[model samples]
Target: MWSGDELDLDAYLARIGYDIGRDGELAPDVRTLTALHRAHVAAIPFENLDVALGRQVPLDLKSLQGKLVDRRRGGYCYEQNSLLAAALERIGFQVAGRGARNRSRGATLPPVTHAVLAVTIDGEQWLADAGFGWQGVLEPVPLRAGARVEQSGWTFGIGVEDEGIHVLRSLRPEGWTDLYAFSPQTLYPGDFTVMNHYSSSHPQSRFLGQVVAQRPGADVRRALVRETLSSVRADGSAEERIVDTADLAVTLEAEFGIELDSEERARLERLHAAGV
Candidate 1:
């Protein structure tokens, strides 16, 4: 029920740089699923500029398509994963939404906020998350106990916790770090809309007064949180720098592959300068 029929499938395919001749044909299979997930994350970045700009982040298909596909803009998890779910559903794949709690911050458990997709191919199911910012998987991870996937040189694994909770983790130089944990209970688009309201508008929301953009590449992962832009390598070493207001627009365009129009750029520049 992701309204896949209404989605512009061809445009979505083109937006992700999916090539039928090279990436394989569109089908409800693991190969196509992997290609689409990988391409979507690599092409479309992860950012929350609208939230910082005090603009509404709409979840409708037309708004998603207009901002993400046509405008060539990036968005946070709700927008990112919703667009991916629509695209996957349009391609004859069975897709469902899952709400996940952010665990990377610390031992304190956060609320269920992140949106991911559960894609079933044949009798086997896969965790296809095209959002998740800098600490996300490049391709789908199999939905099972102790599932380990190696994308390029990076490593990711799944662990089953008590009460049927599933944890997604990344292997670091020291040990395995928990990225996020999700339950088996499926979430709907309406559920996401409710959560999106809090994330986009709430005063205490981390996205409200910050400039966050991320791109997790095979070789390096870069995240711009507020003024600092940090780039981490596969070995877990990171280098960070401050992004001044004067360099905000160029940094977003050149580093994150996000281009803003004149008005959008002006608003965002002012926000960045205010340190909000």
Candidate 2:
């Protein structure tokens, strides 16, 4: 169980660009949660830079704050959601950590590799996730069947499948797409540590040799995968281009706000050259 007693609330708020003082009172309500969610996704991008650099992504609150908040770096699902969970709990919100299996189209349902939050406020349960990279939910939604939530013109909903699994779906021009499926079972800190180790270091893990950076905005989401830069608009339109090796560093810093050091830059260049 992760406790929020030692979380640096002030530093976390500043990192996410959220001003709780402006609201006069720190309330654990839907409005505040929505604002915080939006701010988090906007300010802190979703990236696998550490994994690309062959470093283990830490889950402790202090280490997360140091890397994501103080150093201005982003992280993958485990790291990103863990940081948000700590901040939310410190603000008096009821939070529980949950794990999920990737159920998106064409994805093999592997062991639970995703972490999300189940939050309760005023007798209602909500699903909040700040780490899902590109096609993730932008705002917390009611944890009910057929509950629809609109975010930046994108529509998302929750559905209960057989055996009580909650499936998150997104609306597209074609039809609804399954994002992932999860149960309400609470996951302990040790569970996440084991999964994080596999995710960050396994030979076949997606994060190991790939470079992924994503930043969601009000109108569009920018994502970089290897040499491809894609801008996915909220209206179901997308534009993609292949970035040259010479422009990779500048594109990463400018488009995704990731300023890599010389060593990291060289490492990424080498990965691209090897076509891994």
Best by lDDT: 1
Q: Write the per-residue lDDT of candidate 2 for residues 1-276, one digit (tens) a residue.
A: 465777888888888888767744567889888888878888888999888888778899889988899888888888888888887888888888888888774667688889889989998999999988888877898999999988889899999988789998988888888888999788877788888998998887888787889876768888898888999887788999998778888988898777888998998888876767
Which residue runs of candidate 2 sit more than 4 Å off their true CA positions? none
lDDT value for candidate 1? Answer: 0.91
**Model 1, which residues run further than 4 Å from truth?**
none
Per-model TM values vs. the true structure: 0.98, 0.95
Highest TM-score against the true fold, candidate? 1
Residue-level lDDT of model 1, residues 1-276, one tens digit each, is 887888998899899899798877899988889889999999999999999988999999999999999989999999999999998888899998999999899898677888888888888879988889999999999989999999988999999999889999999999999999998888999998998998999887889888999998889999999999999988889999999989998999999999888998888888888885
Error of 1 at 218 (Å): 1.3
Error of 1 at 104 (Å): 0.6
